[model samples]
Target: MFSPQGPSLRELCVQALSSVEHGYDLLAPKFDHTPFRTPQSMLDATTRALSGLGPFRTGLDVCCGTGAGMGVLGALCQDGTTGVDFSSGMLGQARSAYPNASFVRADARALPFDAGFDLAVTFGALGHFLPEERPALFNGIYRALRPGGLLAFPAGSRPPVTSIAHWATLGFDLALRVRNAVWRPPFVMYYRTNTMQEVSRDLTATGFTVRTVPLSPPGYNLVIARK
Candidate 1:
């Protein structure tokens, strides 16, 4: 659902046809007013979860759309925080919202940082990366963190086939597939392509020690990968 302040249906249709970066650029201004933005409930849970794992120094937010992870990281980390996203439009919103925090425009697959951060987090941005793109993405995140640094995010579990969510997500993924099959500049978001097992394997392959814990929200879990 979207608020009155959010983009109109026509605007969403236009965004759907654009490349992921451009689509997000178009959507960035009103992102927080839409359901697509990471909810405060999840951010709050992330903050609470990371609080125990940290007395962290520097923090990074991978694919930091509108800097949702900035607030989460700020609450947990003691010093510097940065939000990295490819979209200039998204970074603009983030800059306006958190002027004191750093924001960078860079692709997640080629993150431009050394092992400088003690902690990192991502929110609601994974679906844009294809299954094959994940290794590079994970590697970049892993490489950005210092030794013993943690990269964390709230991960969703697969819903059973009998459930409404399962069918809904399946339908959504199917629609995206069909759209990509017929369109140029394909939008990369999908509902069910990635799995926890696959993600864990990727993290491990990238030299992370991976683990998960049940988050406060009933259906979501947190995947923590330590460098």
Candidate 2:
């Protein structure tokens, strides 16, 4: 489901075979044109949901790509926003796109900030982390936020086992496993890596009180956690 402006099949194949950071670097230029970018509708809904909860001062976007989530933070945070990503190419695009916002290249599991953000959010990035790695990621987010600060992200409900989306995701993850087994650097993006229950538990264990706000279009869940 890529547009004409998106990566070609050969380009995508090369990316899929590379490490996650390298793959994202290769895909960053066309990322917004692909289905990978968080949709504007979800963005708007998240903004609306955060409206009453915010008026936040400083915000951070974890794994922010081309800075789509920065738009939401710009509206919600008064002091400005920051977008952090491991991919240099993505951060480069983000810096160019949102010159007013700060962009940093850093690992989400070991964020550089210390209680520096009033709010934190992520979009379409969790699947890159293996389930076991989530605890560290959540802990880093919690440490980055001030006490009582919030962390938010949109998550999709699990697709039905019989649905095409389900089978497609399963096959994709399986293929990725096979590819990684033979590859030097592993690419880590799997649709089934994170689940609501597991994420909730991890967040709680990492000192966040989690809550879910049901989003529109029926399949989305907006998770808000307070540190």
Candidate 3:
């Protein structure tokens, strides 16, 4: 699933053994080469989907990682784009790639931003937050948006029970549970936890008018929440 330029298996093992923040720091340089990086096509599809909803002013990308989501925000927002992530190494890479865009180092659970952005987007990061953590996460995103502003992210629908991906995801989460049980620093990446019903309920409770926008690339939908 990784390109030749991506982290070696040994390097990935070291990263999996470290804390998420430090692990990301170690993996930052090779991250974009990995399949874990959000694909350009997904970002393009999202931009096309959000274009009608936007042409926004200031944009924010929460848990922005290597700043892939910024492409969408940068295109849609006339003013500027900002990417917030806790890993300094990740932020460094983002800043290097998109120097004109603002990059902030902050945890997603407690985002350090006021209601100042017209639009906010996050990608490939929800699996990092557990079920109980959703409340704090959704609330933080809610607080980061201006009145009538929107927070958006793409989430994959559950793979069919008959599909290989379904079994693979289940096995991965099980392996993670086993690893966390025996390991020191848990790598919190679960693929199948964020269901549409559960996430919509949380977003609604956090004061967003939630809706799902179906899009291309198959089995993916944009979860749009308006304040």
Candidate 4:
């Protein structure tokens, strides 16, 4: 699923062996060319889904790798848009791409912001954080949003048990578990942990009124968490 401009198999293996942060740093330069990058169609669908709730002021994009979600913020927010990511390499690429937007280097688990944003969005980064880590990530996002602010993200519906996608995802997670069990600096990525019910519960616990709206494509949902 990688293009010629993307990292090679050897490069990917090297990355897989490293910590998540360093791996991403090594892959950052060619990240946009990879399938791992959030697709443009997904971003457009997210933008359309969030438009009705907007006329927002400042916007924040958590775990904003390469700033793809920043485009969503730029379109919806009137004041300014900011992207926060822990990887300096990713932040550099993001800053280069969207020179007008602000970029911050900080972990999503311990976001370094107050109630300064009216809206926030993240794309295709949920799997990076494990279930136990969700509390810190969501709590930090809650604190970063102003009263009556919103945090939106897209989540896919689970595939049917009979479908190949189901087995594929299950296999992927199993492989990741085995790797973590045997390797150092485990790469945390799982497909099944962030269910809609689980995420909604976490958001509610963090004081956000959680709700879901159908996105453009079927089997995808845009979760809106209001502060």
Candidate 5:
């Protein structure tokens, strides 16, 4: 599902064999061209959904890659926006793309913020964290947000087990597992790592009141949590 300008098979293979950070570094240049980038439709829908909750002053785009979600923050947040990511290469691209927004290089697990953001959003980054890691991740997001602030992200409806998409995703995760077992550094992308039920539970445990709203352009759901 990659475009002609997207990574070649060999390049993808090499990336898949590397650690998550390094793989994202290699992929950052062509990330927006791939299906991996959060789609514009979803971005628009999220913006619309968040607009009602906002008039927010400062917004944070967690794991912001290439700054697609920054556009959403720009529309919703009035004072300023910040995009935080661990990958320097990705942050570099985002800086170039959205010069107005401040970009920070930091791990999501240990966000270097203290109740500074009115709204926090992440797109297409949760699957990189295993299910066991959700608590810390959600806790960090909760910590980054100010009291009564919201955290938002788009999650898709699960594909039926009999669907080809389901099987393909399963196969991809299995392949990644095999590669990581024999490789030096593990590429941590897995298709089945995040589930709605688990995510809701984790957010609740982390002191967020979680709710899902259907996003238009289909196949997507918006998970909005308030601290």
Candidate 6:
């Protein structure tokens, strides 16, 4: 699932053994080459989906690893874009790719901004936050958005039990659970935790008016939460 330039299997093993922050720091240089990066197709689809909601001013990308989501904000926002991530190495790569955009190093659970952005987006990073941790993360994002601002992200339907994808994801999560049970620094990614019902409930509790629209492909939806 990786490109020629992506990290080697041994490198990935090392990363999986390290803490999420330090693991990402070590993988930053080769991250974009891996399947782990948000796909360009997904980004384009999200941009098209969010365009109609716009006339947005400054934008923020939470957990903006390598800044792929910034391209979506860049298209929809009239003002500048900013990317916030905890990994300095990832921020460095993002800064190099989008020099005009701002980058901040901060944990997503405790974001620093307060009502400074008209729009915000996050991609392929939800699984990093466990079910209990989502409250703090969502609360921070809610605080970071200006009144009448919007937060958008893409989410896919859960795969069926009979599907290969379902089993693969299940296996991955199970393996990670085992690893975390014995490992010091747990890599907190799981594929099944963030369901539409769960996320919408959380967003609603945070006072966002939540809604969904069909995206480019089937089984995927663009979640728009207005502040």
- Give Cα distance to truth, residue 88, candidate 5, Å: 0.7
lDDT of candidates 1 onward, in order: 0.91, 0.92, 0.93, 0.92, 0.90, 0.93
Off by over 4 Å in 6: none
Model 3: CA > 4 A from native:
none
Tell me the alpha-carbon RMSD of every candidate: 0.9, 1.0, 0.9, 0.9, 1.1, 0.9
Which pairs of residues have clashing backbones in candidate 4? none
- The 10 consecutive residues of candidate 5 with the worst lDDT sum are 11-20
Candidate 1 residue lDDT tens string, 1-227: 37799999999999999999999999999998998888899999988888888889999999998988899988988888999999999999999989989988999999999998999999987888888999999999888999999999999989998999999999999999999999998999987878888888888998999999888778799999999
Tens-digit lDDT track for model 6 on 173-219?
99999999999989999999999999999999988999999887788
Stronger candidate by lDDT (3 vs 5): 3
TM-score, every prediction: 0.98, 0.97, 0.98, 0.98, 0.97, 0.98
lDDT, residue 49, model 6: 85
How many clashes show up per model?
A: 0, 0, 0, 0, 0, 0
Instruction: Report the Cα lDDT for residue 151, model 5.
Output: 95
- Locate the minimum summed-lDDT window of 10 residues in model 2: 1-10
Q: Which regions of candidate 1 are displaced past 4 Å?
A: none
Q: Clashing residue pairs, candidate 6?
A: none
Clashes of 4: 0
TM-score for predicted model 3 compared with the true structure: 0.98
State model 1's lDDT: 0.91
